[model samples]
Target: MPSSSTQRNPWRYLRDADVLHAAVVTLLAVVLSAGIVWLGYVVHVWRIARRAPTTLRGRWVVLVFGRQLVADAPGADYRGRLARALALLREKTAGRVLLLGGRSGGARSEAEAGHAWLQGQGLPADAHVELEQESVDSLENLRHARGLLQGGDRAEVLPPVALLTSRYHLARCLLLARRLGFDGHAVAAEEGLPRTPRYLALLLMEATYLMWIDLGMRWARLIGHRRMAARIS
Candidate 1:
């Protein structure tokens, strides 16, 4: 009954409302799924941080993750991680310590700075320490470390390994180490993990990174990207 002059073309609209609604729903579903997965990672990190680190019996290697330097000196986080390593070494828990990190816009590489700090703190006369000063990131740090450990044998066949890093960093470190087949335990730099604001902020950032790596690796494996999968290996 509509008059010809009153007729309208549906195509006149720039977009269909139904299509927009479906797009929004799809986007929401993806976001919700991602958040759920990310939350799982957060919970995983929290569990590790709150638990007591496994005590190595003897002759274990403590992989001390490198932190950023503050004004050419070890920052608080850096010192905290190093201090934990020092304590472990003094207790004879770990026979060797491997400091990992490269030059990150500083006068010296993180490992080198850590080595110097260890010296200033007076390392054990018989202590055997190695510095991995070429890895600019955590993945590279762990990869290079595995190579150093491997030599000719695989990393999993080596002695027990402990990943020592900041409380906020333990989760990522452990994840990477395990992915790299290190079978490593986590040692938190700061004693008694508390749910502080700053710590939670750090966790959020770490969670994002954790999720990024997890999803990336998953997608890579899903797509049969052997080289990418092998890199995560």
Candidate 2:
């Protein structure tokens, strides 16, 4: 027989009905808040997907963002992106083409490889192809490309720019381009590359980036840039 003090009533430990109701309400509130955040992210991704292939007119510069090379050669995804850029260049004879990418675990920069490849592809000799070989990411690519453009004699031209990249990557690229004061449009490369698990992962990663940028975390962006530079270096 247990002593009176040792006897435990499990019901006694349970909260009063009012208290349980309040706890349930709090839990529901938290879950609702979480659901709202998840919904917002879903909407953001939907908008990005919808806007990925939107084209803008006027004098446009072709800005091709770079991806990592596989054994010093552009991977299938990057090859598709480059092929699209090349197609745009062939179709639009007015604007200059800028190949933007930096060295990442390679003997040569991505821009260098792109320049060489485009040259070999019979790009017209009169076409002005500029190489930006020092940008490690999308933001850096546009920022550096902007600097290059401003440094040129055509600084005052202020043409609407066309970004060539994977469809999943175009939204964030366009966001950064607008932040850098570019009147930009996207020309996505959705074909050739299979929609694999890696592609889904890339989409999630890009969504996180868009969220971070939207949150205006300057320090986070700086740290991310440093980390990328360290990885490539």
For all candidates in order, the CA lDDT equals 0.76, 0.67
- What 10-residue stretch in candidate 1 is worst by lDDT? 1-10
> Per-residue CA lDDT of candidate 2, range 1-233, in tens?
11233222335424544334334443454377875643465467646665565343555788888888888778777887777777766667337888888876577778878777777778777777888887666777887888787775444555688888887788788878877778877777764334579877777767655654543333324446444223211
Tens-digit per-residue lDDT, 1-233, candidate 1: 21233222324232744333333443454497966766787888777778846355666789999877777678988998888888888889878899998776667778888989988998888788999887767888888898888886673476568899888888888878889888788888887886779989988778766766666566656777676567566
Q: Which stretches of candidate 2 lie over 4 Å from their true place?
A: 1-32, 54-58, 152-157, 191-195, 217-233
- The TM-score measured for candidate 2 stands at 0.70
* Model 1, runs deviating above 4 Å: 1-34, 152-156
Winning candidate number (TM-score) = 1
The residue pairs found clashing in candidate 2 are none
How far out, in Å, is residue 150 in model 2? 1.2
TM-score of each: 0.81, 0.70
